[model samples]
Target: MSSTQLRANDPQIPSSADGSQGLPLLVLGALGVVYGDIGTSPLYAFREALHAAGSPSVSFARLEVLGLLSLIVWALTMVVTIKYVSFVLKADNKGEGGTLSLTALARESFRGRPVWILVLGVIGASLFIGDAIITPAISVLSAVEGLEVVAPTLAEWVVTITVAIILALFLVQRFGTERVASIFGPITALWFLALGVSGLVHIVEQPSVLAAVNPYYGVRFLVVHAEIAIPVLGAVFLAVTGAEALYVDLGHFGRKPIVVAWFAIVFPCLLLNYFGQGAYVLTNPVSEHPFFEMQADWTQLPMVILATAATVIASQAVISGAYSLIRQAMHLNLLPRFHVRHTSETQSGQIYMPQINTLLLICVVVLIISFRSSSALSAAYGIAVTGEMLITAALLFVVMRRIWQWSLLFALLVIIPLAIIDVGFFVANVAKFAHGGWVPVVIALSAAFLMQTWMAGRRLLISKTRADEIPLRTVIESLTKKQPLTVPGTAVFLTSDVEGAPTALLHSLKHYKVLHEKNVILSVVTSSSPFVADNDKIFYESFTPHFSRVIITFGYMETPNVPRALVLAKKLGWKFDIMSTSFFLSRRTLIPAAKGGMPFWQDRIFVALAQNASSATDYFRLPTGRVVELGIQTTI
Candidate 1:
């Protein structure tokens, strides 16, 4: 089987045919994409923890530096290395990985209906969107804040420069990640190298910082300084903020490349830098930006410029991840269909969504303006990152117990400690509710509501439509017995239920009083896997001499193009002609009812979402001129 057809939930790790040949390149690409978010954390993560450690009684000293460094080191080891790389990465859905992808897998594996699992998936995806906005704002702001260190006089231009950089980053997304991907690997490689070198320089001066690797300082600090541990965790969680991205981008780089990249280069560099910062902090107790201060005076300006570039690249990973996530949401019926434009001809996953891009840009810009500084934005960051991680750990337990067929004891044994750790971080971040933490919580709740409403609204629409729907067999038999005025061309009515008469077909018969010479009831299904084989793409069932039910299957990661897929109909003796085909669609105008299943406000939200959703004609790549949409009002 081709690599794309490999199931993500498959027990074994997939090996690419060219895996050995391109091992180095794949590792490089993985570094650029998978590691971008966590890689850039060194810019502000250590600094933020320092700020968080500031209590009235606490002072910047060797103990504090060692304790914070230990916390960061262990956080990375537990969160990224052990939890994600070793465990969560193993849970894939047909070679695909992400919150929604794994959610679908676990949901399917459950013996009975598991609605709560769906809620978990939506919340994970929503908080990811929250992370999407904040990563760019905080990353760019922190990177640009280096200017304050380079030239104290340029401090006032920081926000403006940050905004300009963010705008440019979002503007170029249309060209796709492929266009800018080549430079990402080398730049990030150099960034990590610089991180190690700079930290190495300071560690030589105060080699005692190396002792933080023992993890004893980390545990001791939390125990001894129990009073401020909560706030400290919120900042310490920053060390592994982008750890989920490792699992989210699993499809792009595969399991081996990502895991290999993390241990071999990414993990070690991050450790060195965090420890180096600890060493620097011990000497310069009152330093504002210790990361920049760790470098030599002459290299400070160049490091600032490099950091800015790295932050932009970091933002790209989050943006592209959001696109992948929303596309999955749409496929699984949790969201309205949006236009997904393929930017690279060679790679199917290299897609861009204009609506998501614009929305994210606006949110990021507003955040930069509102917070005006990275330190302020930092208060909003940990909540989403930790919340998403907690959700992932929850889903991981489900995958183990249900999908992986592990015993309950085995599952609990694995997840309990991870849960305790995740819950600790989540609780710590939650304490920041008054300090901008509500920003992400609010965004997550809003997004989860929209997803739930969309799914519920679609179910209601389908249920209501089925009330009046006739079996296609009955329609075909009736048409054969009493032939209506037959037209020359073919008519294709798209419907969700292939067995039932399409609403558009029923409407067409009542108004036009005619049937086409050839009629096809078409239903397109999204499979759970990432790609479907061509041989199994189309399934055809002929109901009568001139009537047929056609079903086309597309993997969640693949686009559904009707004209291209319909070409396969010729194999079943159905001559296909796009010019002679007339596509029929049913557009429902949903009206909120006082006694509907959902809340009245949610019903209204569903109505608005359905109204603005992309049309079936454009989504299915139907010929615009030959398409007709029949509108129907439904009270639900």
Candidate 2:
């Protein structure tokens, strides 16, 4: 079996294939892609936390600064380092890790498909999409807002400049990021180095700022300020918003590289920066933008420029992640198929989706223009991140108990506190609903609703079609007794149901009154795992002298290329020729029913989604000229 096909519980599976020689390079790559979100947090996390504790105009006491800093420090340590790096990373499905990957792993522990687990996975994925849309808007806005500090005269142009940069970023996504991606590591490394050095200088000025490292300060602040704790927790969560990338990008760069980068470089630098900001705030108590103000006047403009670049890289990581997540959703049958364009010849993971990119661009631009400031958008950000984190914690418990075979007591002991922390953050963010938190909530809910509708609608359509479909065995028996005029070439009928006669095949017989010399019933099956082994890709069975069944299995993380997979049939004793073959597909035209399966609104939504979905020819990477689509109008 391929390494990717191994179960999560297998002890022999290696965490990564990159050996010792490649470790350093992998670490560099992790810095750019994995840590982009959290690395840029210093720009506004501390400031937002401070604003939440008291008025921005108020000069907080030394204790308040230390307390807030303490909370930020431990939040990173507990949430990112412990929960993700040490624990969640071990629950990877085969060698891949993400919300959906974990969901697949957990579902595999059961005897049959479980509805609750599927719902959790859908919700987790939906919340992540919400995060993807908001990250670019807020990260770039925060970085560009530094212009207000640079000139104060450019404050009016901040939104305009931000929108222009965002527009340019989305426009270039079509060309692929392979070339520009090389510089991401170096640029991000320099950004982190700057963060450490600036903070170290301030720490030297007042060594006392390091006191925030103790948990006592963080605890004391929460106890004393209980009334404001919810808002404060929500704001502090901004510090670890991008922590999910650690587990999400595990397949790209291994666990070791991400952990090493976080502990050795990313973590220390973030600490220095947060401490430096706190120390700077102590001396210059009224500083509103301490991140830019902490730097010397000569370096402030350069800092702003570098910060903008870092934020762009952060946006890129999340945007790319969004593409990967949506692809997984499509393969798992949770969504209608979208046109997926592979941007790199060698790397299957490098993909670009035009429809997704355009939608993201529109939503992001609307957000930037409507909010007009990073602080305002921050109100809408924490809800999605916290909601996703909570879902991960819930799924982790199931994996521990069932997949790993851990004792129930042991699993509960490990997961409960972590879940509680997640709940705290989630509840805190929920408090911001009227204040703008409703944005991500609305986005996530809408995405989840669409996914449910698609899945439900497909189920109904399948059931309805199956009821009308003739049994393939019966059809083959009838053909044996009375054969029609045989055509010379092969005809492959594509279907979702392997046992039922394909609608196209049945229609062909009724209309043309002819049969091909060879007929193959082809069905594509998506595996629960991320990638399937080539050895296990094709399943073939011959029903009669002229009829056979071919099932091609693809992993949820893969793009289904029917023509390429069909080539594997040669190994199963079937001669496959793309040039001489004709592919038949049943094109569905869905009409909403007056009563039954779904509500009127959802039925309408499902029909719209079906209409907009990419054609099977494009989605399956089949040859366009050899394909014949037969339209079948159906109601549900």
Candidate 3:
């Protein structure tokens, strides 16, 4: 059966929970977390676009500056405002939004699961990881590079300072961000205010640059300079790099707060900053760092300090996002289980994954040392963002047609243009493959390959075990005829297959020659939804007087606690006592056969991943002293 089918009931679209906290505070929180990445783009996006247009000389043509500004303005309008904030945010599944959430929603709309849809989700998620790694490297690097503007001699120290700052950021993740997060909203709001004030000053000085608001200038430039359009478009995409964060963070801030923040604060500040940079370039075309150069001399140092803080907040958001994404992937069976630590008692979303944190730190450091400058790293940035956007567009199309039940013509009208824009940006970024684009490409492909291998190996192992095991009914019938010695305590044997007797239970019967009075054949299932209500969390069935089957379900976004979920069984008349209950689990040792299942290399990868997976006792939050493990050998 499909993952969505495991859900007990169809998911309900609930209202946002922001009412208790008040809209103003939620909006502030949204500004800090949701808008951090895109908010900081003005630091380097415009300058990079100018460089792509071959404007390295002292004076740039008015057409080039105006055209690039126009493109930035309209891209933000079409991509972020219309597509994501207005439309995509509404596609939340059970008040959660992400690639997998949307994928689950789309899967539920059909009677049968579609492999193509799952592939799209996997690709989107994998590319998101690539974006996660590059975002921190480039954001922090770009912000630190501002030092070069304040003192030319300090340019040599940029990379060293950036590495130190990044290392510090990752190291502190174990402590959790609950306390630090409270200040994030205020600091980021101040940063945006600074951006607006700085840009407004320049815009008033050179009011003529405001003409770039006209989309005609952008389109005309692209057509007129078709030869350089590809590279320029690639650079232009940097402005909208963090747009996906809007939808990814929908569950945290809700639709209204994020939308209000964007329209009221973020959108205007970003536009003003981009326009300010254009104005600064128009008069003093030789200025290399338009963002830092446009500022007053007295404010330059403070701007650098503020920019560094904002970029750190941005990096924090991406790192947190990676943790959430990998957790979802693990629960959905797309990846192996990793150790998940809850950093906050109040907030369920505040989780820390050591494995992910260490991986990101290493990747970000390598990218900083290899690329050296934000301008060089810019080449690697757009491809992952564009690819992820394209996949989101594809999934959005399916959702519009199947779930929303929009007419074919209407869905086409809405998605076709957006798809075309995505394709254009993707193709433009692909032209940058040789420069630095291959970094994210390689990262994404490796991630996708690992997920595929795990999934395939799991299916093979299940098939092999199913072929060898006896059905649960047969085992029960045999036990009924000649029952073994009955113990007083309860025994819960966990298994993936509800139809077959658990391997642990079979081994116990074979070796111990006894059965517990109250035996529970427990199975844990992960649904496609983000959070499951307590009412539908457990399903229980009795096959005999002593043998019962219990299924506990958890949402993909949740951390499964089998013992806690089992407590809910009391409501169904099952008297449960933790002290008298013994949890039984089968620990398999996978041996690869020389033949059928997967290629030799993939078998090795899957085996390594399995070996590294967290123990079921800890993952299920079971009492260590009350758990018993049975070791078994399996080959595929």
Candidate 4:
């Protein structure tokens, strides 16, 4: 598919208004949240860069420092700014972005083996869940690690205060972050600009330090200090940790604005400050300024406050990103379904998932106690970041071939370099497994299991229902007729797909044993895309069996709200109010049954997820008072 053909087909593809205006906020939020992994790298990026040599005592040459700064700058420019921002963000699913949305795209284009694409998609999405598990722990723990720097004696209370804050963060999550969210962009923007301003002061003071960008600093450091540099990559990689988060958040910001913010604001500021830190260290090697040390005495308190604000914003982004990821996971069959509340009345992007919040809160508390310092948490961060990156690269390859239709030569040229960087990061991060990095790997693995089990369980349930299912045509022919059993009202059973067995329809007919004279529509909600068009949504067919089936389509980005949909579809069908209609919902209960049975472990997994899964009544936004539930038992 050429870009022109893709656009021609997808007139709803995000335009400049969406990418430029909406994306910055989303990008900022993601940067704020995801950056917690790396934004704090300045605490270590340069300090560790110098330690790339055998000791911190080496004579700091101007060239070495400049080269390191350039590496940081170019890495951000090439990786974050160019590779993802300029390209990847364009790959949206009906103007939404997430791993599964990309998966949906690949599914539509590949049109071949779906299981392989699903495997890759699930791995990538699950890795983010792993990050959701670790980010709060590492992020808050890292920030509170600052107490030791700002005041060493307060270090004893770091764990206590950090845990308190994380607990409180989750506790208040239900109230929503609208008031706080508005300021996320401005605060982060200031943090970057302030960093730049502070760096410029130091850079002018030691102009010679700018030469470190000459490549020799990074190159020579690797050559002369291979032993030390081996471990240092772990820390340097942290500088770009938020880089992937920016791409993950593409749905919020349309890629263009995030790209602008990165190039015009974020990139320059981060580089200037990093080099400024290098400059500060070059001139006064003995100075102990983790971040605020570079500031003048009068400015230290404000800087501390600003840094804290920025850190919180960064953490907030991760927290919110967690909610967003969990929602996507539920929709895509990667996780057990859960209650997801749209928190922001105005912005659909603002969402809340209680299950994830509690989980994150617990993990953060544990991290604060176990690690007690950012250094310990650093080990666990790499695998989640790079593993997801590799998954993204793999998906990107599929996108280029099937959707973008880029030539094999071009795809290989791009993939080889990304693979090298991605694999190196994965291998290096593995060295930290003993330290605490195993935690995220464990989390990601568990998340993947939960998701896979739910999907497997659901598939099994549907298959069993089909086996027992009386075909609609047969049922209608035998039972449905113009007779004394004519019911005064209509009963509509909602389904996800048309062909499969509908337990709801079976339950409705079994219990009621009547047909309405006016209108009784068998509605199936389809994910609207290339398969179906929005205008041609209200299609119906009256099989000779007296059953009129209606299939309605909605885009991926559109959250299904049944009542609103009914109203939109009113013109074509019976008036919702006058129809005297009642909606029938059939809920599934997971239990261990030898009939249609899954493995024992899988059974337990489904039961667990089913227990946690959100009620369908709430998810559909159907008039709660009017919904009648028919519970169907299934052995997973």
Of the pair 1 and 2, which is ahead by TM-score?
2
**Which sequence of candidate numbers ranks them by TM-score, best first?**
3, 2, 1, 4
Which residue pairs come into collision in candidate 3? none
Q: Report model 2's TM-score to 2 decimal places.
A: 0.96
Candidate 1 residue runs with Cα over 4 Å from true position: 1-21, 55-59
Whole-structure CA lDDT of model 2 = 0.91
| Model 4 stretches with alpha carbons more than 4 Å out | 1-40, 48-70, 287-289, 480-484, 518-533, 543-546, 594-597
Off by over 4 Å in 3: 1-18
Task: Say which prediction, candidate 3 or candidate 4, comes out ahead on TM-score.
Answer: 3
lDDT of each: 0.86, 0.91, 0.91, 0.67
**lDDT (Cα, tens digit) per residue for candidate 4, span 1-636:** 011100012122323235344554666654454344446556555554455433556666665566566666655655676667766777766555667777778777854757888887778877887776666666566556665666789878878877887777788788888877767667767777788899899999988877765666666766765665546666666677767666666666555556676667677777788878878877776544445677776766676667667766667777787777676666545566578888778766677777777777777777678777666677777788788888777888888888889999998898778777777768877777887778888888877777787888778777776777766555555554433366666667766546643578667656876656543444545352322344454555554333456665544455556666555455554455623667777787767766446777678767877887887778767777677789988655
Q: List the residue pairs that clash in candidate 2.
A: none
| C-alpha RMSD for every candidate | 4.2, 3.7, 2.8, 4.9
Reference-based lDDT, residue 125, model 4: 77
Better of 2 and 4 by TM-score: 2
Error of 4 at 578 (Å): 7.8
